[model samples]
Target: MKKRWYDYLWIASALYLILGFFNILFAWLGLLCFFLPLIISITTGSKAYCNRYCGRGQLFALLGGRFGLSRQHDIPRWMKSKWFRCGFLLFFLVMFGQMLVNTALVFSGARDLGQAVTLLWTFKLPWHWAYHGGVSPWIAQFAFGFYSVMLTSTVLGLVTMALFKPRSWCVYCPMGTMTQLICRAEYRPERKKTAC
Candidate 1:
């Protein structure tokens, strides 16, 4: 079968899911798998994942294409300004803090710390049951909420891309932001040609 551009999203998502499972089961191999997509995306472009291989992206493309909402528009510069960048950075920092705190709580025997955090965020899923039932309730809730946030963010990204010409989600994506910082240090833009 000729692979469509959208098929890549599904492939990537599947890879991510498998990697997550392996990370939980095999650990070391999972760590390597985690970086695989990141390396591929950086070497190629955000399209390596968002445009091609993300399951969420594939779903979005299908729905948008069917509904005639697939049109892309130019993202305004102001929307990508310093304020937005700072805000996104702050958001990432908060997420990191939450993750650190959750880990600390799990290790320190303050078991319910993680679940309280999830409940505060309105995520009521039973994480332990979803997993192997060995992890504490707090850790389980944290994992559930973490995955929920990831899924929510992906949907939001799709909506942003469908409405914006240049893939708006890339602008505020934490991973993309980090990769771009690395790429900028190594990449130089080609000079424009001018007619004599």
Candidate 2:
């Protein structure tokens, strides 16, 4: 079969996911790898991950496109409101906080709810079973909750993109928001023509 751009993206996303799982299960190295693509995505104004690399995004785009629901359009006023942006920012902050707290708990021997939950939901199949066995029950619950939140957020982003332009998530994604700030200050924009 001929390889497409999306195939590479899927592979990259799979790598990230595997690394993330490993980070949660055995080593911090996996966690370090997680930030690499994130940095690339932000600095380059390219969701290299989402566009050509993310498995979930690729799947959604394919399905939505096939169903005639993937075309980009304008965002609805209500969805683009300041309140919505603020809410998304707040949610992103909460996710970051959860990650930090969970990491601390795992390190301090508190509990492994996050890891356990991820494993339970993600590793039910035979292939997944091979990768199971790292987290506590409580941590598993936390992981499942985290996964649900992330999945919901991603779905919402896809819906937003379908309603607006591609990468609607870039507008409010916490990482993208931060990267935009940096780029705005560091990278000068090209001058536009004056109406006068």
Candidate 3:
């Protein structure tokens, strides 16, 4: 399949990530990438996001194919294991939840607003330097935290692409895993496992 001009969703995603990094609230917009696709996959039992609109995945393709970085190796069985995939998804979800709560606490006045340099972005250097050390109103902190969460996902996606097949990351992606869970396989009585 040849790449199409409209498939450049990753560029928009990158810009939004940068915005979320500086503005925070924009992180919600970034999440639509996952939530929307998860919703569609639930009804269709297909990874529609990967097929059509995953910006990160598209970036991986560009890196691997356009830059000739892909080894094109078969993914190891360990990575493809359901147990490993689900475990990773669970871990990813927990981290995501924790970040959200942290952001909420800061925004809700339940805690002191943490300064810039969340998670690992620039080791605490404030973003959007145009605003005097990247400091903005308190609301900006919430956005920074959200962008940190996104950075985690972005790093994982990049690493997964580098280490395995381009689409291998999809197998362990939290949103994809969630959709696969909701969209269960077709019923087949003969395929049911019998208690040993």
The TM-score of predicted model 3 comes to 0.76
Regions of candidate 2 where Cα sits further than 4 Å from its true position: 1-7, 11-34, 41-57, 69-73, 81-83, 112-131, 134-149, 158-171, 191-196
- C-alpha lDDT values of all predictions: 0.54, 0.52, 0.68
The residue-by-residue lDDT of candidate 1 on 1-196, one tens digit each, is 9987657654655455454332332222323323644786577644354344446445455555665565667777876786776577578658657765766676677755333213323455443323555655555545544554554466566777678742466577665555555566657688988979
- Candidate 2: tens digits of C-alpha lDDT, residues 34-148: 4754676556855454344445455445445565565677666765566776676677677657766765677677864342323222333222322355655444444444543
Query: Which residue pairs in model 3 clash with each other?
Result: 24-143, 117-124
Best by lDDT: 3
Clashing pairs in 2: 9-52, 9-53, 112-139, 113-138, 113-139, 113-140, 114-139, 114-143, 116-140, 117-140
* Clash-forming residue pairs, model 1: 8-52, 8-53, 9-52, 9-53, 9-54, 73-165
TM-score of each model, in listed order: 0.59, 0.54, 0.76
The better candidate by TM-score, 1 or 2, is 1
What's the distance in Å from true for residue 24, model 2? 7.9
* Candidate 3 per-residue C-alpha lDDT over 153-176 given as tens digits, one digit per residue, 9 for 90 to 100: 777767767777766667677777
